[model samples]
Target: MGALKTSKRSDLKNCLTKCKLFRTDVTGSRLYNQRA
Candidate 1:
């Protein structure tokens, strides 16, 4: 039970971070290309 709870929490955190990173990556590339 404890392991499952911890894993679930980490999974959610990873998901959030992944989403943020993906957004940043897309925007970053767009800005970089535009400014270049």
Candidate 2:
């Protein structure tokens, strides 16, 4: 039961990190293309 909780927490953290990275990548690309 304890291990399961830890795994779940890790998964949640990973998901959040991926979401943040994707947002940053999208915004960065938009800004880059606008300059051209």
Candidate 3:
């Protein structure tokens, strides 16, 4: 049970990181477009 919980926590962390990266990518593109 402990191992399962740890794995789930790691999965959540990975998902959050992916979401943050995606958001940054979207914002970065918008800024680039405005500058261009």
Candidate 4:
């Protein structure tokens, strides 16, 4: 049970990181387009 909990926590962290990266990518592209 403890191992399962740790694995789930890591997965959640990974998901959050991915989401943050995607958000940044989208915003960056928008800014770039506006400047062009």
Q: Write the per-residue lDDT of candidate 2 for residues 1-36, one digit (tens) a residue.
A: 999999999999999999999999999999999998
lDDT of 2: 0.99
Model 4, 1-36: lDDT tens digits are 999999999999999999999999999999999999
Best by TM-score: 4
| Candidate 1 per-residue lDDT over residues 1-36, each given as its tens digit | 999999999999999999999999999999999999
lDDT of 4 at 16: 100
Q: Give the C-alpha lDDT of model 1.
A: 1.00
* TM values, all candidates: 0.78, 0.93, 0.92, 0.95
RMSD of candidates 1 onward, in order = 1.0, 0.5, 0.5, 0.4
The lDDT for every candidate, in the order shown, is 1.00, 0.99, 1.00, 1.00
Alpha carbon deviation, residue 28, candidate 3 (Å): 0.3
Q: Give the CA lDDT, 0 to 100, for residue 2 in model 4.
A: 100
Clashing pairs in 3: none
**Candidate 1 runs further than 4 Å off:** none
Scored against the true structure, residue 21 in model 3 reaches a CA lDDT of 100
Any runs in candidate 3 off by more than 4 Å, and if so which?
none
Better of 2 and 3 by TM-score: 2
